[model samples]
Target: MADEVRQHMLECEARTWLRNGYNTPERIQELTLMIANRRGQVSAERLIEEMRRQWRRRSEWLN
Candidate 1:
Protein backbone atom coordinates (compact mmCIF):
# COMPACT_ATOMS: atom_id res chain seq x y z
CA MET A 1 0.00 0.00 0.00
CA ALA A 2 2.73 2.48 0.89
CA ASP A 3 4.84 1.47 -2.05
CA GLU A 4 1.90 1.95 -4.36
CA VAL A 5 1.34 5.45 -3.06
CA ARG A 6 5.02 6.28 -3.37
CA GLN A 7 5.06 5.07 -6.96
CA HIS A 8 2.06 7.23 -7.76
CA MET A 9 3.71 10.27 -6.18
CA LEU A 10 6.85 9.62 -8.19
CA GLU A 11 4.81 9.47 -11.36
CA CYS A 12 3.12 12.71 -10.51
CA GLU A 13 6.45 14.35 -9.81
CA ALA A 14 7.74 13.14 -13.17
CA ARG A 15 4.75 14.59 -14.95
CA THR A 16 5.14 17.88 -13.12
CA TRP A 17 8.78 18.07 -14.06
CA LEU A 18 7.95 17.33 -17.68
CA ARG A 19 5.23 19.94 -17.80
CA ASN A 20 7.29 22.61 -16.09
CA GLY A 21 10.49 21.85 -18.02
CA TYR A 22 12.27 21.64 -14.69
CA ASN A 23 13.95 18.29 -14.81
CA THR A 24 17.53 19.15 -15.51
CA PRO A 25 20.23 16.54 -15.13
CA GLU A 26 21.31 18.05 -11.83
CA ARG A 27 17.78 18.13 -10.51
CA ILE A 28 17.30 14.54 -11.61
CA GLN A 29 20.45 13.54 -9.81
CA GLU A 30 19.36 15.37 -6.70
CA LEU A 31 16.01 13.67 -6.81
CA THR A 32 17.63 10.30 -7.37
CA LEU A 33 19.84 10.75 -4.35
CA MET A 34 16.99 12.09 -2.30
CA ILE A 35 14.84 9.10 -3.12
CA ALA A 36 17.62 6.65 -2.58
CA ASN A 37 18.40 8.10 0.80
CA ARG A 38 14.80 8.29 1.95
CA ARG A 39 13.30 5.19 0.41
CA GLY A 40 11.23 2.99 2.75
CA GLN A 41 11.70 5.42 5.64
CA VAL A 42 9.77 8.58 4.83
CA SER A 43 6.03 8.57 4.32
CA ALA A 44 4.70 9.62 0.93
CA GLU A 45 2.79 12.55 2.41
CA ARG A 46 5.87 13.95 4.08
CA LEU A 47 7.96 13.40 1.00
CA ILE A 48 5.44 15.13 -1.21
CA GLU A 49 5.21 18.05 1.18
CA GLU A 50 8.95 18.50 1.20
CA MET A 51 9.12 18.21 -2.57
CA ARG A 52 6.42 20.82 -2.95
CA ARG A 53 8.23 23.15 -0.62
CA GLN A 54 11.42 22.66 -2.56
CA TRP A 55 9.65 23.30 -5.81
CA ARG A 56 8.10 26.46 -4.49
CA ARG A 57 11.49 27.79 -3.41
CA ARG A 58 13.10 26.56 -6.61
CA SER A 59 10.57 28.21 -8.87
CA GLU A 60 11.95 31.57 -7.83
CA TRP A 61 15.37 30.59 -8.97
CA LEU A 62 13.95 29.01 -12.11
CA ASN A 63 12.17 32.20 -13.03
Candidate 2:
Protein backbone atom coordinates (compact mmCIF):
# COMPACT_ATOMS: atom_id res chain seq x y z
CA MET A 1 0.00 0.00 0.00
CA ALA A 2 1.05 3.60 -0.44
CA ASP A 3 0.90 4.29 3.28
CA GLU A 4 3.17 1.36 4.01
CA VAL A 5 5.67 2.52 1.45
CA ARG A 6 5.65 6.02 2.85
CA GLN A 7 6.16 4.73 6.37
CA HIS A 8 9.07 2.59 5.23
CA MET A 9 10.66 5.54 3.47
CA LEU A 10 10.26 7.70 6.55
CA GLU A 11 11.87 5.04 8.69
CA CYS A 12 14.80 4.78 6.28
CA GLU A 13 15.22 8.55 6.28
CA ALA A 14 15.17 8.68 10.07
CA ARG A 15 17.79 5.95 10.25
CA THR A 16 20.02 7.72 7.80
CA TRP A 17 19.70 10.93 9.74
CA LEU A 18 20.56 9.31 13.03
CA ARG A 19 23.46 7.38 11.54
CA ASN A 20 24.89 10.58 10.15
CA GLY A 21 24.89 12.23 13.64
CA TYR A 22 21.74 14.21 13.12
CA ASN A 23 20.16 12.83 16.26
CA THR A 24 20.31 16.00 18.26
CA PRO A 25 17.14 17.22 19.94
CA GLU A 26 16.70 20.05 17.47
CA ARG A 27 17.05 17.74 14.50
CA ILE A 28 14.70 15.17 16.02
CA GLN A 29 12.14 17.84 16.77
CA GLU A 30 12.39 19.15 13.22
CA LEU A 31 11.94 15.66 11.81
CA THR A 32 9.09 14.93 14.21
CA LEU A 33 7.24 18.01 13.09
CA MET A 34 7.83 17.23 9.42
CA ILE A 35 6.57 13.67 9.84
CA ALA A 36 3.65 14.75 12.00
CA ASN A 37 2.55 17.19 9.35
CA ARG A 38 2.60 14.44 6.74
CA ARG A 39 1.28 11.66 8.96
CA GLY A 40 -0.20 12.17 12.46
CA GLN A 41 1.14 13.50 15.75
CA VAL A 42 0.79 10.23 17.63
CA SER A 43 2.44 8.18 14.93
CA ALA A 44 5.24 10.68 14.53
CA GLU A 45 5.98 10.77 18.25
CA ARG A 46 6.00 6.97 18.50
CA LEU A 47 8.19 6.48 15.46
CA ILE A 48 10.74 9.09 16.52
CA GLU A 49 10.94 7.69 20.04
CA GLU A 50 11.42 4.15 18.74
CA MET A 51 14.09 5.28 16.32
CA ARG A 52 15.90 7.23 19.03
CA ARG A 53 15.90 4.22 21.34
CA GLN A 54 17.27 1.99 18.61
CA TRP A 55 19.94 4.50 17.71
CA ARG A 56 20.95 4.89 21.34
CA ARG A 57 21.35 1.15 21.71
CA ARG A 58 23.55 1.00 18.65
CA SER A 59 25.62 3.88 19.90
CA GLU A 60 26.08 2.20 23.25
CA TRP A 61 27.32 -0.97 21.57
CA LEU A 62 29.77 0.97 19.47
CA ASN A 63 31.15 2.92 22.39
Which ten contiguous residues of candidate 2 have the minimum total lDDT? 54-63
lDDT on C-alpha atoms for all candidate structures: 0.57, 0.75
lDDT of 1 by residue, 1-63 (tens): 999996677656755654555456676556556665777434434544555665656654444
TM-score of each: 0.37, 0.60
Query: Which ranges of candidate 1 are over 4 A from the true structure?
Result: 23-63
- 1-63 per-residue lDDT for model 2 (tens digits): 998997777666667667767687998888889889998999788778767766866655444
Pairs of residues at least 3 apart in sequence or in different chains that clash in candidate 2: none
RMSD of each: 9.7, 4.4
Candidate 1 displacement at residue 17 in angstroms: 0.8
